[model samples]
Target: MDMGRYLFRQVRGSDAAAIYELAVANEYHSDNLPLNRSLIKAYVQRSVKDFAIISSSGVCKNPLYMFVLEDTYTRTVVGVSQIKNILWRLLYQLRLDPFLGENIGKLALKKEDGTWELGGLLLSKEVRGGKLGKLLSYGRLAYLMSKGLAPRMLISGFLKNTFWEYIAIRIGVSKEYNPDKHWRSFKTLTKFMGLLPAHILLAETGIAFGYFEDLFKIPIPIKPESEPARKLLVDMGLCFLKEIEANGILWHGAPWKVIRDDNFMRYKVPQDTIEVDTCKTSCHLDIGMAVLPSDDFRAQYIPVAKLEDGRVYISKKDFSCGKPKHLFIFETKNV
Candidate 1:
């Protein structure tokens, strides 16, 4: 999607310095994406290698991508988003639902194949509005589609709040500010917690003290500030699964096709690509994005020539890698 003065693309090696500057200047720094220069460089290097491997072989063991939203004219990196593949065992759990009664369901990992996590999504305070957040968040998905590597499930986790802080202390694992370590402990706690069979008798007492163990992955309360993020995911076709996989974090997931279809209803894509000699027509406000095919994975919001014969046309010069075949053109909206 076009932000007019901004451009979004995968992280390049030269972006490490700017990324570090952006991270340090931001008031709220995420542990998953630290404010260290060396770390930022490592992330950029890894993303470049990962992109190359995926482009050539069409698969990778560590399928990770780091994307940046840059100020086009200024050439400054103002925002960043990361995508990585992760695996979790599809375990079962018993939940005591107030209205639904006791129900046994698979822990909310969503799919047996694996899951793709959207994390480390951060934007500068100055550029927070006008659907830029949605651009950074959903651009990761667009990148996945460009590579034809959409996972079976997609997820994002929030930070732990005070309510969870108290519960964590009682559970013997104090709230760790680091999200990575906190999530690791949460996973370990769920394993043996399921063995205890006294949930029914100890339910009320557990609630009174705020240390109720469900003998499974405990559901963490969604913090107030994270509500908007959660709502966006829900709007994108994800549901709040009962199984909380991390501390103070609410996890949401659904089949990839569900999200793809939901987004399709909003961001309609052109069925085919039309290469033209020159982009001689006015800009199409409704058309917002053009994505190259798998061999040359790139997405940008460039001017498109007016529709002719019911086909969307773009100039050959729109892409730097020469003429692309079957590029996906997405319609633009507030979403």
Candidate 2:
């Protein structure tokens, strides 16, 4: 298929059915999540609201973009790539604690610095072949850069499997943090106390009480079939940052610039082309801002921009609070 005519556009309300079908297909293929049409509808609605928030804030001077690869010939949508400014919120909502909480703590401690994240890249099975995956992946990077959010790193979490591990190794970046290993020592206590209320236990122990067992990875025989995908990620310059077996998964980090240079911007958003649209979707919203407990909590706010000259800006500020700043996390397994 000639991909030239297939432009990537922001998903519209009319795309609910297509998006729902895609979610169903993915869930069926991966055994990842149960397919519920109402849930998928909610997800699409949330995406629309997030876009509106970005536009109204004028934070990046562009709406937080979610692109759906459209077959101009058939007018069918094929894939999706989205850039979320506050992706940690998504991780938190999913109750993907420890993994997201650890990172949020790191971010709080480093409040003087600036960082952005790219997330949620899902492509249809038919389009997973060839350079299209790479195109959609990097295509998102290009779009973010244009929005003035040139993120230093692109973070992703992959399931613990030989195929994925092998891919990280090939990419020349591999680290192991077994969530299971970390949780083994605490399992007995957790199991014994599992019946007690979490708040009561925390009060008694002076330590937060939460079961971390479900996050650990179970060792399974690797099928002979799963190595190629791992190889591809390694070849693309992604590396394993750490292994959190206690959480049943591994955390990987990839540098965005390594995939493509600044020049890749031309392929996604053209210069001097400002397109705007209205999004009137209803969804839940939560905002979290926190200051670190460390000294010198002076917040550093920097502007994000697409132009080399820095035409767009996002401001960050520090605020005083009774407890540590609240961190928002978002996660959805019920697709």
Tell me, by TM-score, which candidate is best.
Answer: 1
lDDT of 2 at 77: 70
Residue range 1-335, candidate 2, lDDT tens digits: 44344545555667767866776676432211114566545656666765555545555422345556666678887766555443221111122246445221110111212234343455677766534555445555544543445566654443433433443344344443222332234543233223222211001111111212222322333232223433444555656543332222333446567644533322222323311222111111211112223322111111112233422211232222222321211111121
Q: State the lDDT of candidate 1 residue by residue for 1-335, as single tens digits.
A: 34655666788888888888888888555545766688778878988899888867667876779998878888888888888887653333337668756543333443345687788888888887555676677778777776778787887765544534555555565633434444446455454334324332112221111224455445444344456666777778886555544334435678889888765435544555454555432444434455545344445555554454555555555545444433433543222
Q: What is the lDDT of residue 204 in candidate 2?
A: 11
User: Cα lDDT of all candidates, in order?
Assistant: 0.61, 0.39
Q: What value does the lDDT take at residue 287 in candidate 2?
A: 16
Query: Per-prediction count of colliding residue pairs?
Result: 1, 34
Q: What is the lDDT of residue 14 in candidate 1?
A: 89
Candidate 2 lDDT at 189 equals: 23
